[model samples]
Each structure stands twice: as structure tokens, then as C-alpha cells.
Target chain A: MPGWYYDKKELRHSPSAQDGIDYKTEMRYRKEGARLIINTGSKMDLGYNTMATGVVYYHRFYMFHSFKQFPRYVTACCCLFLAGKVEETPKKCKDIIKTAKSLLTDQKFTTFGEDPKEEVMTLERILLQTIKFDLQVEHPYQYLLKYAKCLKGDKQKLQKMVQMAWTFVNDSLCTTLALQWEPEIIAVALMYLAGKLSKFEVVDWMGRNTKHCRWWDMFVEDVTMDLLEDICHQVLDLYSQSDAPIHPDSPPLHSNAKQQMPSLRPSNGQEKTLSPDRPPSVNAKGPPLSDVPQFPYQTFTGAPPPAAAYASVFPSSMAGPPGGPPPHLSGPPPHIAAPPPAVFSYVNHPPPFSTVVPPGAPPYFPANAPPPGQPPQHRPYYPPQ
Target chain B: MSFEKSHTYEALNRIGRGAYGTVYKAKDKKTGNDVALKRVCVPLSEDGIPMNTLREISLLRQLNTHDHPNIVRLLDVCHGQQMERELIMYLVFEHVEQDLSTYIERHSKGFSGVQIRSLSREILNGVDFLHSNRIVHRDLKPQNLLVTHDGHIKLADFGLAKTYDFEMKLTSVVVTLWYRAPEVLLGLTYATPVDIWSIGCIIVELYSLKPLFCGESDGDQLSKIFRVLGKPPESEWPEENISIKWNSFNVNSQISIDRICPNICETAYDLIMSMLTFNPKRRITALEALNHRFFLEEPINT
Candidate 1:
């Protein structure tokens, strides 16, 4: 059961190192993340394990090799690509390079000096090799397994906990927490939090249709702040830091910037569109299960995202030091701006109040999600600034 | 950019084209291991290799963890160079012969009882291992089953297999139209029993040189099944919500198995009949079928 996600180098490195958990290192991750966001000129949901993959890659890369050996820019790209692959939110190399070129437009592209594109591309390849081509990023599955095993005595409660935890892990991409903690810890924290709010705090509200009332009570006992604290402080945001450019020389493109990727570049309707129901290719069908081995997606929540722009969340946190500012720390946006960009705000371990699913009963979900009779938790949707 | 690691291999002829990549039979220069190198040599565009790469990745991950002389093992995954985004997944196995389909096509004229039994047991062994782990090989056609030089049968290509979590079950059209099961044909929520239908097809194919349930459409396909095995009682079919009418199969009037194979032992006929049952709840599970009299008296390798 020991997976490739378990990295020894990461365990020994500072910051990302097991004991390297602290305030300063966490803040740097956030700052660098903002640089990536500012570079992209758009905001990713930073949800699920997208940001987590970025941050975790940073934490892992810094373990064995230093900035001396691997430049931060290349390392940054590695983190992003690796994390993107893990979270199943794969981004193209062109976008990655564009981000790098723009973000470090001023830095004398130390690796490829003249052509920033080649440098970023080359760095991306190196990162792919470093990770041994294993893309089964960890997610809430691992954490839920542990939680499920702990609640094995109570199958009914465990089932509910697993589903809620799954929802948290599934949508963690919406928050910056995925950038910080491992999926296991995040899973534990999410189950703990959900158990507290809907399952426990409002037991009177949760109509116990079956004889599983006592099991619900014990769920509350299982939650611990010690665990919650790790999720809160360790899971970080990259944009909250100073690297995020709040003013956006030209305000960040509104949601309608039509930032269609090159591969997805819209057609001028000159050619007939292929049927959306076109069959999966024969030889190139679906997930190959034949000769070469692949990692199960169940363990996809491990690695963190590369650099991001959530640093604006900690506009002040990303500054060189406390009061003395270099002027870029204004803010990422308003609501999602709480956590910085570089910081690994993991999805498994979401922040306290950012409801991935609003605080009401959704028709699709049947958890402590109010009654079919009750109204669903309706919340306003805001595009990421 | 350093191509410092000059790894060489004596590339031989291409074995076959998978959904996403071209598989080559090759020899490693240093180790001399007969490696099945799958090369995803294509652009990253829509026309590129299909789910072949991912299918290989997903299937091999689990099969590699398993140790069965009959199961294909995935050794190493190599992503090399700029010519094309090629992924060379190295496997330590030899290309014995053409796949089962080729073998059946050329030699099914009159497969000796022993030969048929041996093929069945080997196929069953590999299938049983997969089922025990709750993995269903959605595609179990002769094309995906490989025969080793020593006459051992190895199951490969799990691209269409369904691994259900505690939440949902994927019951899509995973098998080739010929080998696809009946429920999947009816668009019902199937579990592992679909594999049983596939096994039945393989069983008939062993005797008949043709695909047993081969049909042009879903309706025709089910008609072929009803022709061989009478329709399931309405009470047995919980598919009242389904719209693919049973009459569409045009077999409310019963038909006979003699029309399909005409040549097979009574026991083998009975087994196939049970396997091709429309009700998945009634299909023979892998282990239960293994204990049948066919394997008990027929020639079977350990």
C-alpha cells in the first residue's frame, strides 16, 4: 500500500520536509504561486488538488535539489505541470511556457536566455522525467480509506462520511487548500468538519431515519483541532501573497476574455464539426489497461500544484518582510483573495467557511443535505478576479 | 538537451495497432529481454492514438500487481524524445503467436477437445483472478487474449474493464459488437456477469469459426441471442424502464442453438446456454463455472 506519492526526499527537505511545516516557508509558496497566476492572466478554480499538486511539487523539488541546481522558474513549471497532470486538469505546455515567459519576462531566462519558450519547454520535460512519469496524484481516497476503516464498526455512518469526504475531495479544486496538505490529512479534516457541521452540530436537523443515531454522536468525538489546525494552517493559498498583481495593468480579463486554449481554439464554422458522440478511438481508446502500468486515480490527491496566483490572498503575506512593501501586494480579488497563490491551499483540507457546495440541501446530493422538502443551500456565484 | 542515455533496441515487426498506439515486438540490446514496447508515436491531436495509452496504463497497473503466468505483466514505462510524444511501456514477455482471434480463424476448423479445454481453462484462470479483485474485463474477445509459445493463455487489453467504486457502476458498450454481452446490448446496468457473456462467445468461437452473436445493431444482436437461448421471462427482466423492446430482437418466437454452432458437446452446449443467459443475476460466475464438469474431465493445465 506504500505508494509512489510517499517521497523520502520531500520528507527530508526544509519547508516541504515533514517537520518543515511553519509560517515563513508557507508564505513563500504563496508568493511564488501568485507569480504563476499573474503569469497565466487567468484564475484556475485552484480547486480540488490542482493547487495542491503545484505546492506539493514545489515542496518536493526543493527537497533534494536547491534553487542553485534547479532554477525556481523551471521548478515552478514542473510543479504546475505535475500537479495539473495529477488533478486531471492537464494544461498544455504552450500555456505553461507562456506563463513562465510572461512571469519571468524580465529575468534573463538563465536556462534558454534568448527564447523564453524553449527554456520553459525544456524545463517542463526535465520535470516530467524527475517524477518517473507516475501521475496518480493523491486525493481524498486515501484519507477516506483511513476514515472508513476507523468507522468500520459503524458502516452506515462510514458510508455517509465517505460520500461527503468524496464530495470535498472531488471539488477541492475550487479552493486553494489542495496546494498545502496531503490528501489523507485533508480527507480526515473534511470528514471531521462535515461531521461537525451537518452531521453533529445540527443532529436535531438531520432526521435520523434509521437507528444510526449513536454512530453520529461518536463522529463528533473523532474530530480534533490538532488535525483541523494542520488542514487550516498547512493548506495554503498562493494569490493571498504579494506576488499577485492586483491592478492588472489592464484589469484582469473579465470571465468573457474567451481564453480558449490553442488546442481548443474555436472554429470559424468553416468546417463541419465532428459529432460530439464520436466513438473513443479503437487503438487509442480509453484508459489503457494492457501492458504498461498506471497509477490508480484513487491516490491522486498527493502532490500539490505548481506556482499559482492565489498569492493575492495574502497580498501582505507575500511581501519580503512585515511592513516594508515593494508595492505588488495589493490583493488577488476580493472573496477568493484570502489565501495567496503560491501557498498550497489543499482541497482535501478546505478552509472553514468556503463552502465548496453552498450551505443548503442540493437535490443531487443526499447527505445531511437538508430534506427533499427543505430548500437547497443557494449561494451567489462570482467569477474569479 | 542531452540524449546522453543511448538506450538501443533491435526493433522488429509491428504486432498490432491498439486503440491509441502501435505495439512492436522488440529485443533490448543490453538485457535481451523480449519486450513488448507500445509506442504512442503520434501527435497530441484528436486524430492521435485513442485511449490506448491510458488503457494500457490503467490495466497494467493492476495486472502487474498480480502474479499469474497467464496474466500479462507491465515492466517499465519509457517516454522518449521530440519526434512524437511516444510512450514505450516495456513488458518482459515474448510474442508467442497471433492473438486468439487469429488462432481461432486459422485453426478452428476442428479444434481437438483437449485443445479447446486447455484454451478455456487458461482464459478462465486469467478471468477469475480479475473478477476476484472486483475488476471486470469488459472486453474479453479473442483479440485481447494472447497465446504464449508454451500454449498458455494470457489476458491482455483491459481498456474497457469497469472498476466500480462504492458509488457507481459503469455499464457502457465496452466490448466489440460481436463479443459484447446481452445486457450491455440492452443498455442495462451490468456488473461482472457481462464477462460471462464474453466467455460464452469465446466458448462458441472455439468451435464455430465465426463470431457467435455477431449482429449489425443492438436489436439484431439480441435477436441472435434469443435465437440461441429463448427469451428471459418478463418477471426475470427488471428492465421495465428500458425502451429497447425485446420484440425488437424479433425472438418472442423461440429459436434453436443448432442454428448457431451445430457442433459442440452437450455439456459445452449447456455451459454456453447458461453463460449467455439474459438475466445477469442468472449468469454463471467465474468460479462456479470453473468447477463445472468440462474442466474436471477435460485436459487442463494446472
Candidate 2:
């Protein structure tokens, strides 16, 4: 099986970041994209496995290609379409597209382009290539249930714990933990979190106890407290952010300096509407751009005038290159004939790796290169400095 | 992001037409290796990629990771040119000189007793590997088994294969009818045993130099099987097979294995009969067949 895991540092400088998208904005895009897949899949009556697989595919796809290059919603739908087939619950691309159309607002749906069916079908090929055709994905849900069965606890409490962990696994799809750890480790960590939350302790696990034996050790050997706590915190972090009600009119509070330091402001009004909590009010009017305060450092092109920053970030047309003619289409659609070339120039001119990497950091790329014999294209696109 | 298919692989000649697409003998430009490229044309429909194509690719990709010697190697999978209405996918496999059918035909005097024993063991080893991995090669026949120049067998043609666990009622229209199992003919649910039944038919063909149960239709296929193994006991008849009546087949007595394959030893006859058992539950598995006395009685030539 192909190893899909990457460390924290690798994720910090993801392909989306290389394409000039800030890390926080890229994460927001992922959360919204995952939500889109889940909602559309549920609307189409697809099972959780299919939807989860789609989200994993969406996450893995962005690791190689930029979220800016391919619209997240279109890729989400294509992922779900491909996931349905992979999970043996095949759904027609038209049905998924139709469901997506109903779920997305008029402005957001426009990102799918003129012919949504053709757009998704073309991206389906790209999605397959990006994922290296490693279609089989193992999820934490099965491990959660299997471990629950082995733990001796009150029946109702165990059931509740399992249910909570299952939800955690679902929410974890919105994070990059799936790309950083195996499903088995995720399952154990979530179960540990659920146990603490539900106040259920596994005093007996039907296994002999060694000195200082942890419950997780029975399932996965050498699972350090730090690793388990880290996975739990990642899932817990989602809840911490989701606790605050995100009103359509209010700006997201970048309370932490760490968040504000790396993330660019939402490039356009369309992206501002991608808040998961306000999907139905996607077209709800927000404060005018003039009224919103400008942060000088929020511009990705460092120290530029705020007006020049906004001009460089905003595309003249949303349905241009990012959503424009698919590679297979023989002729460029008339609407895509004149694309804003400046928007994507940064894709080829990423900042130096040293600028992003802390000093004394271990070498990441050479050790983590894809196994030899994989097609050259499968290698992650590390932009030239 | 895939490399241009034409640039990566240079087609040497057309191999043959398979169930899903055309096969070609090709050479890999990067590695300078001979390869067989199976080109599957996926129509650009509203449904997107076909489920079978996806399943086949995913399953083969997973299975190839094990690098089992008895199974064909899937070196690479790349997309070809996309036409107006269809997308082409090329599955690059390591090229083998000939299939078992060609191998059997080339040796006009039929396989020696030892050769049959070795080939049967290799075939069982491949089937056992698949079954252990929860995969069933739904289409198993002489033509699907590739024989290297060194007399090794590699199971191929996974177009109809599926990863089966418990009771998976797959499409009944699988496997060549001549090698199909009785449960499948009777429209009953099947699992890995179906492959075992195909292997049995193949074992008989190795001796007879022809298909053991050559039936033109589903019913005829069952009749031919019953004619040899005898109509299964009424108690053994599956309740799911309501269409096929118990009294339909006129077969009253089972034919002796010695009469059908006179040259085979007692151990070989026993193993083949065990595989050909009417009831799938009663039929021997690939793993069990590998451990049978037939293989232990003689030393196979390396």
C-alpha cells in the first residue's frame, strides 16, 4: 500500500501555499470542501464511507495540486463521484452535480463553470492522476468499532464512547490528520479522547497488563502519550473553533497572532461566503469591502500597498483559468480566452524553502520523495525559489 | 499529470482483444523493458469512469503491491489520448511469451504427469493467494493463465475479478460457461469456490487436451457437469436455485474419474474430484488442494 502520511512541516508548506494561498485560507477551503462533499453525498443518499473517502481524496488531491488551480467544490464533487465508484456505491456524476448545484449558492455554483458535467468529468481524470490511482483508503470508523468491541465496559457507555469517536473521525476529515497518521492510530487517539469526555474508563480490556500498560498499547504498540495527545488536540481544535457562532456579516477574528502571521485575507467576496456554518445564507450580504479594516501584512506579496494587494489577489472573472477550459478541451471557451495571468504567476515563483522552514529543521523532501518507479509526475511539485 | 502514453510506451504489435479492451505488445522507453499494454476505452458519459474499470484498477493495483510470483505484474497505469467522447486508459503489464492455452497447444503430446502436477500446483498457489487476500478471479481459464518461457504460471485477466468476502451475489454472467461452477449456473450466490471449480475444469483439460464440460448454454453447462459428477442430491440442491428443478437432469450415476482421465494417478483423480464437488460448501478450496496427496506423491521438477 502507498504511504499517504506527511509530517507537520510538510503540511505547513502545502501545494496550496505554494500557489500563493495562505495556510489558514487553505484550511478554510478544505473545511468547506469537506462539508460540501458530506452534504452533497447525504443529499444523494451515499453512505458515510463513500463521503469520507471523498473527503480523504479531496485532502490528498490538494497536497499535490493547488486549491487555487482547481476550484474546491468541483474537485469535491469529482472526489465524491470517484469515491462512490471506489466504495462500490456508484452514483452518476450528473446526480452529484445536480445535488451540488442545489446545495451551493448562485455565486458559488458559478465556480463549476458553464458545463458542470464536463468540468467535473475532466477533473475526474486529474483527480485520479493526483492521487496516484491509490483508490483503496482505510478509515478510522472500522478500527473504532473493532477496538470498542474488545474493551470491557458498561454496554451503554461503550456504545456512547464509540458513537462519539465515530463523530470525531468524521470531523477529523476536515483536518490534515488523515494525511499525517494512519487510520489505526487515529482510531486509538479518538477513542481515548471519547473515553475522557464520556467519563468511561477501560479497567479491563481482556488482555494481560504489562508494567505501565496503556489501553492503546494493546491495540497499537509504542503509541506514545505525545502522539495520542497531538491527534486528540487536532480533532479538539476543530470543536474549539466551531464553538463560536460565525455570523455572515461578522469578520473572522484572527485573535491569535500565529494564525494572522501566515494567512492571507480572503481574496474575494466569494471565498468569504465559504464559511461552513452559514451555507444556506451563502449569498447573504456581508459588510462592504470598503468598510472592512485592512491589515498590511495580510497581503501575500509582502509590504505591497493595500490597493495593489487587493488588485493582484482578485481575479477579473471567477470563471477564468481556475475554472476555465479543462486540459482535454480542444479549444478554450470564449469566456476563458482572456484570463488574468498575473493571478497564477506566484505558482511558479514560491518563496524560498528556508523562509518557511525554521533553522535546524530536519530535511523533509529528500527523505519523503515518492518511492522510485512511481511516475515522475507523482512527485509533489515543490516550486522553484 | 501522467506522461504522454505514446512517449512512454512504443507499441510493438497488437497482442489480442480482451473482454474490456485491446492488448498490445509494447516497449517501455524509460526502462527499456517489454510490456503488454491493455488499452481500455472509457466512454465519456455522464456516469464518468465505469465502476468495473475502477474496481479492476484498484484491486489489481493493491494485489500487485504484494509482487506475488504466480500473479501478473501491473507495472504502471497511464491515461491515453482523450477523444471527443471517450477516454482511453493504458494498463502496462510485464509481457509473458504465451498463455497456458498456447503452452498446452505447443506441447502436442499433452503435459507429462509431472508437468501437469507442477502446473496444477502453481495454478493452485495463485488461486490460494487471491482467495487469502479476499479476491476472487471470476474469470479463470487456460487463456487467462500466462505461462512464462520457464514454465511458470501467472494468473491474468482480472476484468471480472472482485474482492469477495462473505456472501457476495455478484453478476451471474461471469467466467466462460464451460469453466463456470454449478452454483453460478443455478443462479445462486457464490464466493471463492467458483474459482476452484474453474480450476477443476482446467485440470481436466490438461489431460483431455480440450474443455472438460463444453456447453453452449447455462443449462447445457449444468447438464454436462451433472453428467460427470452425477446430479447433486436433492438435499444438496440450493434453495436459491428455484428456476432449476431437481428432476430436470436425467443423470442417474456419476462417471468414474479413471474413465474420464485414464492416465492420471489415484491421488490426482482424488484431488480433481474433490474440486469438482457439486456443492460449493463441499468443494475443496485452493489452499486445501495445494496440500493434497496429488502434489506430495511426486517430486516436481524445478
Every candidate's DockQ is 0.05, 0.41
CA lDDT of A256 in candidate 2? Answer: 33
Q: Pick the candidate with the highest lDDT.
A: 2
Write one digit per residue (lDDT tens) for candidate 1, span B102-190.
78777845687678877887888888888886668786888889877666788876533321110122223232577778778778787
Candidate 2 residue-wise lDDT at B202: 95
Cα deviation at A268, candidate 2, in Å, is 36
- lDDT per residue for candidate 1 within A1-385, as digits (tens), equals 2234333334334444344445444445434543453234234333434554565555444543444455566666656655565555666655665556654545434654576455555554455444444444556645554444444323333333344444444334333344455565676676654443223222232233464443333333443444463343223221122222433332122121111110111123222221112311122222222321111111111111211222232122221112221112222222432222222212222111222232453321122223333422321222123
Local error of candidate 2 at residue B239 (angstroms): 13
- What's the C-alpha lDDT at position A313 in model 2? 26
* Model 1 interface Cα RMSD in Å: 5.3
Q: Give a tens-digit lDDT track for model 2, residues A1-385.
A: 2368898898989989998999878887887788788778867767777888999999999998898889999999999999999999988888998998887788889999999998999898888867767898888877876677678766545654564466567768888889999899999988876665453557677664775366667778788755875686676445324212222222233333222111111223222211112221211232433322233122211212122232332222211222332222324344543233222111121110101122355322222123433332211211111
lDDT of each: 0.50, 0.69
Worst lDDT window (10 residues) for model 2 chain B?
B162-171
